[model samples]
Target chain A: MNNQLLPERTVYLVSDGTGITVETFSNAVLSQFDQVRFKEIHLPFICSIEKAKEAVIKINNTANETGYPPIIFSTLVNIDIMNLLKTANCIFIDLFGTFINHIEQAIGHKSNNSIGRSHMVSDSEKYRNRIDAINFSLSHDDGQFVNQLNKADVILIGVSRCGKTPTSLYLAMQYAIKAANFPLTPDDFERNTLPATIVPFKSKLFGLSILPERLSEVRNERRPNSKYATLEQCRYEVSESEKMMRREGISWLSTTTKSIEEISTTVLQEIGLSRTLA
Target chain B: MNNQLLPERTVYLVSDGTGITVETFSNAVLSQFDQVRFKEIHLPFICSIEKAKEAVIKINNTANETGYPPIIFSTLVNIDIMNLLKTANCIFIDLFGTFINHIEQAIGHKSNNSIGRSHMVSDSEKYRNRIDAINFSLSHDDGQFVNQLNKADVILIGVSRCGKTPTSLYLAMQYAIKAANFPLTPDDFERNTLPATIVPFKSKLFGLSILPERLSEVRNERRPNSKYATLEQCRYEVSESEKMMRREGISWLSTTTKSIEEISTTVLQEIGLSRTLA
Candidate 1:
């Protein structure tokens, strides 16, 4: 047996909501400790004292079985439930308690102590804006809603499979930005001019380009052995699209090495769109 | 002037990649202190020592201007760059350093120490899976791809405007789960049975219902004064859909008060789907 195999520990993600915040936060912290194996137990929606007691029993059982104190990462807002959970035979990391106290002290006011408001669609205006943005983006994807170009906060133009759809959707979902994407086809390349449909909204247009090799590889996954996926075709499309963007004085970014998050951030920053949901 | 108003603090989110990890982490932490205002500065793609120096200068300037040291929350992986950032006039919260050290000691191995791998699409299989899931979810949204029901990991059925599309997209994007959503129409309510297309995938079906008043309010915003936007119609559809779900032995939840994150998590857990991406 390899002695280097680190001992395993139990980690519980306890929350009153879906456990997303606690899970993501714990994962970010645990990711730093790559050597220790973790058995994650998610105790979600533990809002009541009874549920908290059940969780404590489960945590104690795990500690007994493992001969090590389990680590509990909790985002519970109810003080009673949090106090009950502290009774478990584990190293309780109250992820929210200390921070909430600090914040309350700094603000000189008590929080509403509401449960599960972090992701709630509580505000009618924000909810409506998000829903509207989602519907608009879906309808306008891949050059489908050219007639509605004026509705977009930003329009993304690029060759096929250049991270346009995902970035647009991210911007819409995360920030309620009305983003539309249009594909530049071979015909557009031959014309060597901005599409007539998008010229009216030139200022809102952004271009995404990718390395020809990467574009070809991405396209080949969906349409194998086709002209659309050919490296030569990819090269031509990228070259022409960059030229068109330059001539039109539209800013562009390459998506070759960037993730969807990176691409969306850059697009929002470049277009000066505020993140409404954040 | 309101004496209770807390002074604002300057907070920096620094990372080598998309800055998503640090941004999300800091936001989650800062959200607890809602009374204390914050001015967020995002320094993304800080991969080199030169860029780190520039960030240091900016941080120091903020400290001087604010008369309080800025709070630097960083996820830097490079030791040299991390060390250089320490020179900044700020309260440095080394988000990754101590954890890396703990992990190194436990694992008896060093991390790859590579920059910007958190959001990298370096693994072709994972990237392809994510892209495929996105395409599949989009095509199957809103009862569009009934013929492809068998391909879905989970199928969310609900009345119109029950937060189905955004939840499906979130599942696909965050977990690489092929989620399909179908809307139950008035005709389906009259028929009083599961749709023919989804009958074969009964085990994979999940139901989303919403409060009738809230549903009507949501629909009224889109199509005012229509029968579809009537509270009576919403009540009928929600009642019928819940009955159908019960008869079919499919589990269900209400999206009236839950966030998209909560809805997605419940669906995945109820359907026994493992999260493929973090």
Candidate 2:
């Protein structure tokens, strides 16, 4: 079915922090309803009673105008504010409150219920490591600073525009993994070997290849109608890179239709790095 | 209470996708219980019944060894696989199942219930924009490619090592915001004005300042004992940058104690950009 022709619904992701957790949860859940088109609203940093009341008013107004109750997925930790938000004219899903009680009972301790702790810089050492990883990924991007390639937890290799840079950044930002990406140019294909700098870190290598059509589309956006962006060049580069990776026995995947999250997860899984989610 | 003195718990985040959503939700909920120490295990991309059974076995073994039931937060969509996982000796929290039924009742439609759809590149246009944003942020980082600064949705201005780079990248990766960052170097501070290239786009500028001590520590990591890494020099740069931003009437914040997610959200909010979370 055409997504536009599907039924429309309004959904709100309300939280006292950046609203990222609640938004992620709601998006995953709502993606299951492929037959519905959702208009999402993010009401983040709603920690106080005043903010909660304002959200309730906004949610109710949306409901009144749409002639249907909006759905609210909230991670508000303040009991009073959560109670106020629950009074809104919507199907409220208490993401935190529902689990906190059960977890408290199981653990034999009451939750502190303070707001905005999840994404805070509570552990300065861990936060510092994440920042360091970002800096490492940035400095080592696109095969630059190859002398320091030994510091990378995972080094991604692929043809140009085959989903290396963004995936590297995501791995660094989300997992605090120091990721370095090297682009496989025509010279590397001609050599028919991994770069000398990466030869020692074979276990740290992960390869990403893309479909030629998608690679051409992506490249053409930057260099329109150029020989460099032509479909034939893209096809040659992708196939050569894939053959090279296979010959070297390096684990790889095609990133033609995958999201950055998926590509990063696959790379981590392939490289056997199981980091706790940041 | 001292966190180390509290009871330890074993928790598992199981999913048929990247496990990011469940991990995010579980982290936020678990952070509320500061008294409990958690050892987290992530089992992602578990789509088949065999994987589900394996996860059950792992959870049961963990429970037996810990002498307590492990807590399981799962987003498995397949009914059969979810039922198999539920048989484990653990506090099974079905994150998706708990909400899908209510949402179905509200919308009067059964969900598609497919696995791994949430983080897939289902919408090529949106995914392409995110990649473009990432590329823009990279090319425009730290005052490079300022000739195209007009294309930026928000330009972050701050002293060196004041949390500008990571925040810019996070905004681009997470929200697809074309964020460009320029360091407020000693040259800009000596001139006592905003950079000439940014004068025309003052309205798009947001400033980030860091505590001098923290800035010194961060800079010390890169260039130890250098004059630029001294706390006294850091104070001068931070104060001068703040004075310049104030004189230019740009919205600014202190990143001394904030996370990258927090800084990005605040920048978006201050710049009046309400992008849907990707």
Model 1 spans with C-alpha error above 4 angstroms: A1-10, A33-39, A61-70, A77-80, A83-92, A97-115, A275-278, B1-7, B98-114, B276-278
How much of the true A–B contact set does each candidate keep?
0.31, 0.84
Q: TM-score for each prediction?
A: 0.89, 0.95
DockQ of each: 0.37, 0.78
Question: Which tens-of-lDDT digit does each residue in A47-121 have in candidate 1?
Answer: 999999999999999989988778887888888999999999987777666455554554356666766556666
Top candidate (TM-score):
2
lDDT of 1 by residue, B1-278 (tens): 45258778888888887777777666666655555677888888899988999999999999899887788878888889999999988877766664555545443556666776667766667767887888889999998877778889999888888989999998988778999998888888788877788888888889999999999998998899999999898888888888888888889999987777778878877888875343
Tell me the docking grade of candidate 2: medium
- Interface RMSD, candidates in the order listed: 3.6, 1.2
Deviation (Å) of A262 in candidate 2: 0.9
Chain A TM-score compared with the true chain A, each model in order: 0.91, 0.93
Candidate 2 at B107: error in angstroms? 3.3
lDDT (tens digit, per residue) of candidate 2 on A204-235: 89999999998898899889999889999998
